[model samples]
Target: MATAAVAGALGLLWDWLWSERFWLPHNVSWADLERPGVGNFPRARHVLSAFPLAAGIFSVRLLFERFIAKPCAIHLGIQESVPHQAQPNAILEKVYTSITKCPDGKRLEGLSKQLDWDVRKIQGWFRHRRNQDKPPTLTKFCESMWRFTFYLCIFCYGIRFLWSSPWFWDTRQCWHNYPYQDFLIMFVHHLATIGLITFSYINNMVRVGTLVMCLHDSSDFLLEAAKLANYAKYQRLCDTLFVVFSVIFVITRLGIYPFWVLNTTLFESWEIIGPYSSWWLFNGLLLVLQVLHIVWSYLIAQIACKALVRGKVSKDDRSDVESSSEEEDVPTGNKKCPYDGSSSNGANQVNGHMRNNCWAEE
Candidate 1:
C-alpha cells in the first residue's frame, strides 16, 4: 500500500505538471465541493447509458464468435486438447497434493523404487496429474467471451463518449483556470470514477470518470482481441495484435493516463475542493489500481521478452504453461501441422497407428 500510494502520488505529480493543474483555483477548499454549478447535463442520467451500450456489443461479439471464430478455429485445426483418462487413485492423489507437485530427482528415484516403475513413467504420471488441473473447454470459452465482450464494449463506449464530448477534444478549455503540484492518480481515478458514476451519479463527477475510463480502455481492445485471435487460431493476426497491444498499453496506460489525466484529476480537483474522508478513500482506491497495473506490467514484460527472444507471442505468459514439453512437441518453427481428416465414424490410421487416439475411454 505504501508503495502503491507513492506510485499514485508520482503518477498524479506527472499529470499535474502536464495538465497544468497548478494554475487553477488559487485557494480551493472542501467547501468548494458543494459549490453549485449550472449548464452541465445531469451526469447521472447518462450513467445508465453504459449498460445498454455494453449489452449491444456483447451480443455482437457472441454472434461473431459462434459463427466466425469457432468455424475459423476448426478450419485451422485447433480443437480442444485430448482429455487424458483420469486416475481416481486417492492415495496417489494425496501424495501429489501433500508433497511436491514435480518431485525432485531423489524423491522420483525413491518413488520409482517403491512403484517398481522407471523414472520416466513417474515423470509422465506427474505430467498427467498436472494435466487434470486443465480447465474445461466451456470454462475457457466463457472466460474468453467475457473478456471479449468487456473489451469490445469498453472500447466502443470510450469512442462514443469522446465523440459526444467537445470538452475533451478542445484543449483550450482545459487548464484555462487551474492550480497544481501533484502525483499520478490516473489508474485509480478511473476505477473510482466508474464507482462514483454507478453509485453517486448526482455528484456530477461522472463525466470526469467517463473520460478517465475512456483513456484507460483505449488499449484493452487490442489485448483481448489478441487473445481471441489466438483462440480462433489466427496466429499471425494474434501476433500482430499482441505487438500493437504492448505498444498501445505502454502509451495509453503507462504514459498518458498518469501524466495527462491524473494531472487533471489530482491537482485540479484538490484546488477546487479541500480534503474530505472520501478524498482519502478515493486516493487509496487509486493506489490499489496502480499496484495492479504494476503487477500486470511484470507479466507484460515476460511476454515482451518471449516475443523478442523466443520470437513467439503468448496469451497468458503470467501463469506457467500447462506443459512446456507438450507444447514443444508441436515443434518450434512456423511449421503448421496437417490435420488428419478422419470423420466422426472413422479414425485416421497414420503410419499403421490410429492417430485420433482417445485416452478418455481408459
Candidate 2:
C-alpha cells in the first residue's frame, strides 16, 4: 500500500514537471507544436528511444570486448602478471575489506599482536593483497580499445552529420526556435552529460547539444589510443598521441567550446529567442560543463609539463590502476622482510620497495 502511494506521488510529480507552462514559452502551446502526420520535428517522446539504444550499445560493447579486444590483446602480447598472494587471515581480511587497506602504525601494532605476526610481514601482506585487486593489463588494454573505437566512430559520424547543415557554418542557427532540433553516446557514465542531453532533447536544443558532444568526442579517442599504445609498450607512439590529444583537447574544449559554442548558447541564443526560465537552466548546465573542461585542461597541462621534463610519457594518474605506497614482496618461507636478505637498513628496504613507476608502461 505504501509502495503504491509512493509510485502514485512520483507519477504526479513527473507529470507536473513536464507541464507545457513550465517548459514552453507563453506564445507556444502543445497543440500548436503537435503534428497530425509524419514530420521531421523532434518530440519529447523521442528521448525514450535512447534508453533501448543505450542498452543495445552496452550489449554490443560486451561482445566487442570479448571477441575483438581480447584477440587484439593476445596479438599485442599484453598478458596479466601474477602478483604474490597474501596468506588467508580472517582479522587481516576483515580489516582490508571493511576498515582500511593500509593500516596506520597504531592499527598495525594491534594487528601484529593479534595475528602473532611481524609488522613487516603485515605490510607485505597488505601490498600483495592490493595488487591482487588490480585488474590485469590485458583487461585495461581491452577497455581502452573499446572506448577508442566508440569515440572514433562517433566523432566521424558527428562530422558527416554536421557537414551540410546550416548550423555547422553559422553558430546563430542553433536558435531557430524560441526552438528546437535534433543528439551523443559517451554520456552513459557522466551524470552531468546525461542531464544536459536529456534537457537538450526535451527542449529541442539538440543542434547545440550535438555540437557539444562532437567537440568532446574529438579528443577522447586520442586519449584512449594513447593508453592502448602505452599498454602495448609503444612508448614513442604513446607520447606522440598524448601530445596530439593535449593540443586538440585545449583547442576544442578551452578555445573553441567557449568562444564559439558558449557564445551562441549564452549571448546569441538569448538575443535571438529572448530569455525564459528554461533558457537560464540550460545555460547553467553548459556553464557547469565548462568548469569541468577547465579543471581537466589544467591536469593535462601538468601531465604534459612533467612528460617534457622526464623526456618520456609519464604514468597517467587518472588511469584505472591506482598507485599504492606499499610494494614489498610477500615472503614465502621466512618471516623476515624482503630487505633483511640484502641489507640491515629497514629504511632502505622500504624506500626500495616504493615503486614510483606505474604498471601500465612497464
Judged by lDDT, which candidate is best? 2
Give a tens-digit lDDT track for model 2, residues 1-362. 99999999999999898777667666766666675652355566766666787778789989999999999998999876665677998889999998546698999999999989999789778767776776777887888898789878877877887787778799888777645343332222222235566676677676776677677778777878888887788877877787788788779878999999999989988788777778888888778777867876776766665556765675433222322333333244534332232222111111122111111010
The parts of candidate 2 lying over 4 Å away from their true place are: 1-15, 178-193, 316-362
Candidate 1 off by > 4 Å: 1-72, 105-110, 136-142, 170-204, 291-295, 298-302, 314-362
Kindly give the number of clashing pairs for every candidate: 25, 0
With candidate 1 superimposed using the best TM-score fit, by how many Å does residue 279's alpha carbon deviate from the native?
1.7
Window of ten residues with lowest summed lDDT in model 2: 353-362
Error of 2 at 281 (Å): 0.8
lDDT of each: 0.50, 0.68
Question: Where does candidate 2 clash, by residue pair?
Answer: none
